[model samples]
Target: MKELYFRAMDAIHNACLFVAGAFLVIIVLIIPYGVFTRYVLNSAASWPEPLAILLMIVISFLSAVVCYREYLHIGVGVLPAFLHKPAKSFLGWILEMLMVATNLFMFIWGIKLCQTTWHQAIPEFPIITVGLAYLPIPIGGGLTVLFVIERFLTQKFFSEPEPETISQLTTE
Candidate 1:
């Protein structure tokens, strides 16, 4: 089960990285093209603005999944450090539960939002529907929830150590 979970996570991580890399490359190329066209050619790249926005959305969602998978999200550290082990564990559980709830909420709402926008096409990119554009939210949120659950299960059943803190990692 753990292996399966890790495999799935690895696949998702690689896929997201690839998508993010492509999106970034597109953005980089488009910006230079837009600049050159406007300055030298005296005309704008017709698709650059909309395409850049779309790429921004994709990059944000993919990077968010990467961050979640890596356990790099921002959080308060003082409370965890000051608490006893049991207290810290309990607090961590509560935090994870809250995160699960938030992810579930985003997943449900994101799907609904996408469904409602399914028929609507983006103004500049008419080839794709808004549903497709917005689909990443639910997908990324679902992945995040999965990773969180995996972490919870591993800690609960396997006694994995809590993630290290900055203070713990640095020597005085």
Candidate 2:
């Protein structure tokens, strides 16, 4: 059952990586193109600016979920470093609970925030509603909740794997 959940969440992790990478590529290409058009062509294109902003928001939020899962998110470790194994484990649990609370806050309010802006259409792009751009908040928050649950069950952060574990995993 745990393996099944890990497999599922691994798929989500990969999908997030792909989406964030794609958005980054698009941003890199479009921003330069936008600059080129503005300066060389003497035509300021509005599409690229807003489009980049939208992609950035998606990338940022989605990438945040990935970061949290990987334990890439910034945290305080100095105190934990000094603690014994039991104390460290307790601190880890406390921090994990706090993260779940924060994720839940984002998840609940994010839906309301998204809905409130649903009617407002982006002036630059009529086809896409403003609400659509805000979707990453809830998405990321929900994913975080799942990851926290996984951590609880596994008794691990699933963050950085130790070198020995990595070697063992590869061998197995």
Q: Which candidate achieves the best TM-score against the true structure?
A: 2
Give me the displacement of residue 77 in model 1, in angstroms. 0.9
Clashing pairs in 1: none
Q: Model 2 scores what on Cα lDDT? A: 0.83
Q: What TM-score against the true fold does each predicted structure earn? A: 0.86, 0.88
Give the candidate number with the greatest lDDT.
2
- RMSD (Å) of each candidate, 1 decimal: 5.0, 4.3
The all-Cα superposition gives candidate 2 an RMSD in Å to the true structure of 4.3
Q: Write the per-residue lDDT of candidate 1 for residues 1-172, one digit (tens) a residue.
A: 8889878877877788788888989999898898899899998778897888888998898888776666556667777778888888888899888889998988999999999999998888899899989988898889888878777866642132345411132244
Candidate 2 displacement at residue 33 in angstroms:
1.9
Which whole-number lDDT from 0 to 100 does residue 43 have in model 1?
85
lDDT of 2 by residue, 1-172 (tens): 9899999988888788888888889999999989999999999888999999999999898878877776667877688778888888888899999989999999999999999998899999998888888888988899999989988988874246444423211233
Clashes of 1: 0
Which stretches of candidate 2 lie above 4 Å from their native place? 157-172
Model 2 residue 113 distance off true place after TM-score fit, in angstroms? 0.6
